[model samples]
Target: MLLRDRVALITGGTSGIGLSTAELFLREGARVAIVGRSEDKGKRALERLEVLGEVTFHRGDVSKEEDSERIVKEVVSRYGRIDILVNAAGVFTGAPLIEMSVEDWDRTIAVNLRGTFLMTKFSLPHMGEAIVNVSSTAGVSPYPNGTAYCSAKAAVIAFSKALALELAGRGIRVNVVAPGLTDTPMLRGIAGSEERMREFASLVPLGRIATPEEVAEAILFLASPKARYVTGQVLVVDGGMTAGRVTTAGSRAAVR
Candidate 1:
């Protein structure tokens, strides 16, 4: 119940990591506002979240300035203040730089990078404590054929660190969580089938993609007061993929 009595606002709250975080926040006692662009998804997510605790749906496009302002205003109008803000709304496109369209690249940057800035910018005035942004392992490590995603996500990490400094004096902490291959609709759509899923899993040191809940847990920790002294940090939750390449050194014991 770390968030007991707190007010939380989650972008991309309709699915994947965002939705999981919303549910966890509710269970921990926060009144949450779930923001999404899809009306149907928002309604469905709201219905499910309502059963857990106090929740509301704020439909908007985070990449748009107007929507960002309106979303923050609506959430405040409903709940008065925001204790935790999670910018989890994101999109991905798979194509090599040479093959990628200009529109695709712009959209990726808009949603993953600009969206974060807009949300945090408008919400800063009404914030009570912290903000946890969702980046990707690709942000730290690169993703093949995913130039746009990698670039945007990497920018998110840098932007968050800079924001953390700007907001530290205000008692509002900003941090980032970079997840590796997580089991989500976004990844599933790319994998396409179970065989491809297995192929995807084979690359991870952990041998499997993480669940949305696992990523959500890291987000919760950063958003909670337990991390009060921590700020301007990026917590990488990608198992050991970014740790380094797998080695056979463990198999051979040294003569000691």
Candidate 2:
């Protein structure tokens, strides 16, 4: 059990990568608390997790400072201390730069970027351990009409790196896991059509999309003692998408 007796708090844990990570942590001998915005979803996740180990669910918007602070307090009050913090709560919105409104940009940044900051801020005092910030390949590569989402994710990468340096002296490690095109409910929602989803999956070098569990596995490695010396790093689990190249006529372009 790599995480034996550890306590983890995961934001946006009702579904997707967050839920999978919570489940994996519990199986590895960790107690977990998951936060979601919907009570029904939170309760369902809590019920499912309870079958594995000690699990608590808090329903709240991670973008709110009070909710973030309250969740940290609630977890510490119940679990004594927090060994891991996973800021997996995020939103994805796509629109052409010229069409994207201020509200859209603000909302995207608020939940994906600000939420991560607030959660880390509140969890730091209780976290003498590890923190994993979930980023996206969009942070490293440009996607069409993903201005707000891309910028927010890129900010997470930068924020986690800075945080890692700031907390190194305290024995606290911070790292970012940038997942590629994962087949989460969130991604499915953005698909809107089956054809669109298939097209997106076809672009991956694996000829398929990643499961939430795959991404969670990378996150677990970063959070566990196995990565004790790993900090200020961005681990990209993109199924080789960013490594693919393009050939046109007698010319070729290589991608890194």
Candidate 3:
């Protein structure tokens, strides 16, 4: 009952990490409002989460100011106020900079970066406790064909740090959770096949990709009272992928 009677709003809650976090929050005694762009997905999420606790789904694109404002209003209208806000809505467009079109870049930033800004702006008045913005290890570590996504996620970390300082006096703690490769529908779409996913996992030190629940656990900690003194920080849940290059020779040597 870490969040007993608290109210939480989670964007991109239709699937993946956001949906997992919503379930965790509800089980922890929080009234949850899940937001997503797909009405059908939102309905499905509602059906799945309603049995756990007081859960509702709000369908709207976070990239739009009107939608962000309206969604926040609806959540507040029902829950009275927001104790936690989790900005987890994002998009990944993998293409080299020269090959990437202006439209694709704009859409990526709109959903991943602008969406976070709009949601936080509108939800601030109702939020008094915590804000956990989902970032990625890609934000700190660079890779090919991730120009827009990496930039947006990196900005999220910077944004959260600055906002944390600004909101400290108001008792609002802002933090970021940067997860590495995760096992989600989005990752499945990206990986395309099981063999490719296994290949990706082989590159990680832990030999496996993360699960949504694992990342959700981190989010729950940051959002809960357990992290009252934790703010302006980035928690990396990457299975040690970012720790250092794990070479076979190095692994053998270390074992000796």
C-alpha lDDT of all candidate models, in order: 0.92, 0.91, 0.94
lDDT of 1 by residue, 1-256 (tens): 8999999999999999999999999998999999999999999998889999999999999999999999999989989988899999999988979999999999999999999999988988889999999999889999689899999999999999998999988999999999998888888998899999899888887778899999999999999999999999999998688997675674254322
lDDT tens readout by residue for model 3, 58-126: 999999999999999999999999999999999988999999999999998899889999999999988
For model 3 the local lDDT of residue 67 reads 97
The true-structure Cα RMSD of candidate 1 reads: 2.1
Q: Kindly report which residue pairs in candidate 3 clash with one another.
A: none
lDDT of 1 at 168: 89
lDDT of 2: 0.91
- Give candidate 2's TM-score: 0.95
What would the C-alpha RMSD of candidate 2 be, to one decimal place?
A: 2.7
Best by TM-score: 3
Clashing pairs in 2: none
Top model number, lDDT: 3
Better of 2 and 3 by TM-score: 3
* Stretch of 10 with least lDDT, candidate 3: 135-144
- In angstroms, the error of model 3 at 17 is 0.3
The stretch of ten residues in a row with the least summed lDDT in candidate 2 is 247-256
